[model samples]
Target chain A: MSAPPTPPDPTSDAAMTRRSFLRGTAAFGGLTALAASLAPLRELSDFSSTEQFLQKYYKEMTPSDMAKVIARIEREVQHQYGVRPHVRDLKPMDGVEFVYCLNLTRCIGCRKCVHACVAENNQSRNPEIQYIRVLKMPHGSMDVEKGDHNYKDAQVPDKGFFYMPVQCQQCKNPPCVKVCPVNATWQEKDGITVIDYDWCIGCRYCEAACPYFARRFNFTKPEIPKDRLNPEMAYLGNRPRKMGVMEKCHFCIQRTRAGKYPACLEVCPVGARKFGNILDPESEVSHILREKRVFIQLKEEMGTSPRFYYYFDK
Target chain B: MDPRPTRPGNSKSSRTNLWLGGLTVGFLGLAGLFLAGTRSPRPARADIPPVDKKFLETTPWRQTYADLVKAKEDLSDYDCYGCHEKNKPPPIRFDDKGKIIIPKEHANIVMGHGSHDRNDLCYNCHNEQNLETLQVRDGRQVKFDNIPLLCGSCHGPTLRDWDAGAHGRTSGFWDRKLGEAQRLSCANCHNPHSPRIPPREPAPGPHTLHETTPPAQPGH
Candidate 1:
């Protein structure tokens, strides 16, 4: 430099006043405190924002994009659970419209199906998320309100009660899919309603809209023991769901898409549960609906057109 | 020939030996042909029980209940023939009041079958001579596996429902191409004696934030 520039005079008309100087200092200090206070929020934003913003809607994603996302999820699950999860994006089988039938007369009020669902779905163990709820109803009543779910009996089919187990109806006219603001949930070709865990904004609109009370929300980061985490996970079904997302029974999509029965159907000791493709006339569900006097749950007014049917021998 | 000085009986003996050998081989060939033509019936010795032809002919309805199919208690273990082999014991003995008295060995069993006390007798279902086999109303012996036919004779509607895959459980596969669908037999779910399904402890109920009780009214 040619020479040191002469300093400006403090008393000059253009110079800062003492009030202005103090105001500047205070403003700088306030901004510093805010940045420090919001440090955790910034960390959260960094962790989620990039991946979440990049995530495309489930139906909008291409095959390669879905593969990449599945691989990423596999890595994340492995990092968290210390177990390598087989996360797959299985499409629905052709000409398959699945239906479930529960025989109210045969149901012994045993909840083996409930436990089997939890285990197969890799639900949160600490918070205890279960998809199936068996209601102990009075012998003559079909009212769900009068039914007690918390009945602790020495044996089931209580002396004067009949057991009814309820789960996701997998409706053809699903209200939950309609109310999702983010389009996180939709009906698959096989008539299964599935939610994309990553895309859900945690608004719980679908949870509120569900008539059967089938949806579950992940309020906190779900904690599952390493040993208890089901490694065979489906991308849109039983994969390790993150915090602030919604989940429900997807009819064990991981297993069912591979031509296996749902966990609930497999575990029913009394042979009370039945599942099959409704499109086929010879399928068990179709046979039950055709021959037996089968009725859908809550079919009076709310026409969800549920695939689940409850029937007894006439 | 003259030089050899053969004995006069040599030619006759050779012919006799040849005939004997031919007869032995022909007998063995005939026995082999008989065995090949007909399957040898299982030996019906006194020590070995006779094969139940009815049992061999009957095919059991597919059992879908895995638990019942895998049940530990097997009928063979009971050995019904153990006591009934030599003694043709009467199926039931009546007291002076005409009440059926179970024999000492069967005292532990409770008989609550449908109208069994009045209209039915043990011989109606149980074969009189062969206690191991069940009998249809027409007196045809039915195997244990074909118990549905015996039950179907009375429960026509239920059998129809069972056949149509409405009343009982069908497990395994929806698509027959993928796997076999098994329909459960009556004995799989119901006790043949009591025929009524009993209750058992349920699995843990749902753990929702709110219980399943009806929501409280605003004023209440």
Candidate 2:
């Protein structure tokens, strides 16, 4: 009523109005007012500019940090889906370079990996993020599937269509990094590139600049149905992305940090995906890329130096 | 929230009502929360139908929830108590002197540990501690691991096999290069409570046990 006293600056990002503060700590006992006030509990699909105001991308958000971010996500999920979704801690590996590989020959166009990726990364529903694109390549002609993945109109087989899934290369020298007008997107020491969504001005330069077409923009405030949301959230990668921002595949950093394989690699029905640390010579991905005759996406020209490698058995 | 006052009415009554409403809601909310916190830790097995009754035997197995299979017609329908039970089938059996013994059937029960020596049980490494505890990282509290950790007790050989990938299942399919590193849980392969033994080698000639072992030579 009286300028709401500026919400008292949130008292160092932890303390709040004593009423709400005590209520959240007592959430296990059901802080009914806090739950009722914050849950919003509606089908929050309308991605208006109003939502963009509330949604801060990774770069802008600092204090309430990853824990509060996850807590907010869990509360939202619990309110919407009646299930507690877990947001995982997706952090870059230390001295462990993340790399991905696809067996283009084995991928059979079955979208099990896509569904797995959607669930594991906690991407929004209704225009879900397919971290890996499985395009139907023309037989004996790599040129057919080499085009963009956004082909519409019930992609039935024309003649000899083979599926090829494309995703972020976690490139060694990512061009998208160079193209950023603002220093919003940067590569981590672990060889993975990340975009601070808050810092991004929605300029979409990184999306266009990526040679592999790995980056995606949030045209709307992305709405994840509580039921469909994956709880395991990462910090920079798939942590409930906001509207009017750009995002891309993060190689499931959270899962990898915890000594677990990426969700897509785990759920591939045909074992089409492989992931590991490239720096570790003993890592599976390193051995595969070293031993196998692997093909890089656009090996000749762009020279972005992507970490992703592909091969198919003859 | 700024009050844009849709209707022009009261100078004092509406404001008083708003504050009163806020206080009333806050009081009730806090009261309910306090009641919930003070409630006792729930008794685990309060849900399953009584074992004394022929409920388990009469109920036909339902495969809906992989963790649970009940033998009852109402299972397809519903039983409110089933959830309280946590679907824990009655603790299998006890031994002499009241110490609950691991069943021999459990020894043979390998969920899929054939790739390893299939004798490990659930509690080999798992104890009372560390279950359901949350590890806070990056301001988030995730679990220790998804699958229940166990079977590392007496089978150190298998543990290393699992960690380094000489043996044990990967989460998905087998690969020659990547196969050795991605590890899996002991339960992914073998059933802990009821396990199976390796089949005996067939007798020679489908006849008697007349086949003799090769003589033990002193040194080859």
Compared with the true structure, what per-residue lDDT tens digits does model 2 show for residues B130-189?
Answer: 323222222233232332323443355545434543233345322324343344445444
lDDT of 1 by residue, B10-103 (tens): 7786676566555545544554555444454533322312222231121332232334446654445346876666457565777897766777
True contacts kept of 1: 0.34
What stretches of model 1 exceed 4 Å from their correct place? A1-53, B1-78, B86-89, B94-100, B115-120, B209-220
Error of 1 at A208 (Å): 1.1
DockQ score for model 2: 0.02
Model 1: lDDT of residue B10: 76
Q: Model 2, residue B74: what's the lDDT?
A: 39
Q: For candidate 1, what is the DockQ-based docking class?
A: incorrect
iRMSD, all candidates: 35.5, 23.7
For each candidate, what's the DockQ? Answer: 0.12, 0.02
